[model samples]
Target: MLLLFLSVLLTLIYCSHGDLIADTCRKTQYPLICISTLRSNPHSRSADVKGLVRFILKAALGKANTILNLANDLLKKTKDPILRQSLDTCISVYQDALDEIPIAIENVGKNNVEASDNASATFVDADTCEESFSNSPFAADNKAVKQLAVVAEDIIGSLG
Candidate 1:
């Protein structure tokens, strides 16, 4: 009987929070990405809307760091001047993204609406980086960064 009761309790908790995750994700433009990303993080089960925004901002920061590293790595490996120039641009924009994400995370933690605008800034950074790679080999990495920034921006926008 105790085991059965525990199972039911767990189910109730999951179902309730699952609904919240689903409902909140629906507000974003990329509902599927929002749902999957939130559900993948254990903290999302207990997070309110502001907490969710922070979670996404944290994720965006990590992605920005990764893309920045990729640009740095590619810059080291290439000999082409044009590609080097593009990588230089990507490196600059991604560094800006890295700087903005932490501010967004902090603002979101404080429940400041400026968090949304900060995320928009990150989105612009990603777009600039992606555009710099228009003919470069590292386009895919930059595209992923841009998409994550958009996801973060969309999720934050949903809060208002």
Candidate 2:
């Protein structure tokens, strides 16, 4: 009897895990990235949609801040006007990304059902930074920013 109970319990656990993450990930463009990113977070194991969105947005905000700090650091290393201009622009992009996050969080909290998509700045801010450095010597600076932004946007889309 205990063995039978254990089998059913294990089965339920396996199915719920799929339903919580994998099934939700299916709704996004980057399902593999979504599953991998969310699953890596300790809080995600029991997170519902709002909790998942909050975790993802917070992570993305952290990445945006990192990008901002990296750009500021790069600015300190150079006196070149062109490089400084590019870095400043990239920094602004990350700042915008950071600013948008709070609004997205609030919109998610509203539970409007349609607000999350419209509320998102998504990958636009990151894309701007990436494009600014695409032909510059600062392409290396854009790498992490672009990757994190894409992951953030994908996760946000999955929420809706």
Candidate 3:
């Protein structure tokens, strides 16, 4: 888990483009992640606060989709019932998180930032998915998914 966080952290720390991205993200909890993710986008240079929020959510949504892909791939390869069930739960949780991202974007568009904030904070499902699997052989995969979820969570948490 630490390894995955650090790896993702590296991606956040470097490769940022526009100075405005870093400047705007300075108020965020995970500024590096915000800057790294936002600045790399072609549309970020002229993005306003709402645009930043949308971009941040989009980055999180991407991570959630990746988690879903990982879970689906693992599900196809696994014959163990326990692992299958856990992955199934993860799939659902990730989908929920994915759904939240679009709603958040819409909320931001409507100037309903409080609602967007609430939607962003609704990432407990991902945590629930991680805790579903204890010290099983699938622990590594669970941790990876958890880390990605954290990235998503961090992006949302940093929206303020």
lDDT of 1 at 80: 88
Compared with the true structure, all predictions reach lDDT values of: 0.77, 0.66, 0.64
Name the top lDDT candidate.
1
For lDDT, candidate 2 versus 3, the one ahead is 2
Model 2: colliding residue pairs = none
Instruction: Mark the 10 consecutive residues where model 1 has the least summed lDDT.
Output: 136-145
- Model 1 bad stretches (over 4 Å): 1-10, 109-111, 136-138
Highest TM-score: give the candidate number.
Answer: 1
lDDT of 3 at 4: 100
For candidate 2, what is the TM-score? 0.75
Q: Over the stretch 1-160, how does candidate 3's per-residue lDDT look in tens digits?
A: 9999999876664434355567667765556666677767878766666677677667666766777888899899999999899889888887887777677667664645553554444456556677767744445544443443344344445454
Q: Pairing residues by index, what is the TM-score of model 1? A: 0.85
TM-score of each: 0.85, 0.75, 0.67
Clashing pairs in 1: none
Model 1 clashes, total count: 0
Q: How many clashing residue pairs appear in each of the predictions shown?
A: 0, 0, 0
